[model samples]
Target: MQSANLQKQKLELIEKIIHTDDQNTLDFLKSILNDETSDYELTDEQKQIVEEATAKYYSGEEPSFTWDEVKNNIRKRNFQD
Candidate 1:
C-alpha cells in the first residue's frame, strides 16, 4: 500500500476507536495499552532498576512478592502521610 493510503487508514481507525463505545473495541484498546512496549518509556533510573532486577532474577537470589502483597504495598504507599 502507498504511504498516503496507509496514513489515511490509520487516521480512520483512530477516529473509530475514539468514537466507538463498543465493549470489544474497548477491550482491544485495553490489550494495546497493556502491551509492555506501550507502558511508560523508562527513565535512566528505571532502566537501571530493571537491569538490576534482571541480574538478580538470573542469579536466583531475587526476592518474590505475591500480587496481593504488591497491591497492599501500593495501597499503603498511597495512604502514607
Candidate 2:
C-alpha cells in the first residue's frame, strides 16, 4: 500500500517534470531515461571472446558442473572459513 502511494507520487512528479521548458532539467531527464533503456553493443573483442567461449563449450573443452556439485562446492566453501 505504501509502495503504491510512492509509485503514484513518482509518476505525478515525472509527469510534471516532462512538461517543463527548462533545457537543463530536460537534458538531465533525457540522460536518466536514456541510461534506463540503453542497449549496450558488444565490441569486436567482446564478440570474439564470446564466440571462443561458445566454441569451447560446444567442443566440451570447457568444464561444466551439475547443480548438485555446485551446491556441494558452495557448502564446502562456506564451512572452510
Candidate 3:
C-alpha cells in the first residue's frame, strides 16, 4: 500500500518536473536530490528542549490543542466586547 502511494507520488513529481520550465525551481529540485550537507543546525540547549517536549507529548504529559481550539482561544482573548 505504501509502495503504491510512493510510486504515485513519484509519478506526480515526474509530471511536475516535466511541465516545469523555471530554471530556479529546477535548480532547487536538483540541489535537493544532489545535496548531502544540511545547513540547519540546533544548539545543544535547543536540542535538549526539543527532545524534552517531544518526550512529554508522546508520554501524554503535555497538553496539545488543535488549530481550531487555538484560534478560538485567541479570539476569546482579543475580541471581548
Candidate whose lDDT is highest = 3
lDDT of each: 0.86, 0.89, 0.92
TM-score between candidate 2 and the true structure: 0.43
Per-model TM-score versus the true fold: 0.34, 0.43, 0.49
Instruction: Name every residue pair that clashes in candidate 2.
Output: none
Candidate 1, residues 1-81, lDDT tens digits: the string is: 579989999999889988998997788678888863444488999999999999998888987789999999999999994
Please, what are the lDDT tens digits per residue for candidate 3 over residues 1-81?
569889999999999999998998997888789974756699999999999999999999999999999999999989985
- By TM-score, the best candidate is 3
Residue lDDT tens for model 2, 1-81: 579889999999889997898997887788887876645699999999999999998999998889999999999999998
Error of 3 at 53 (Å): 0.6
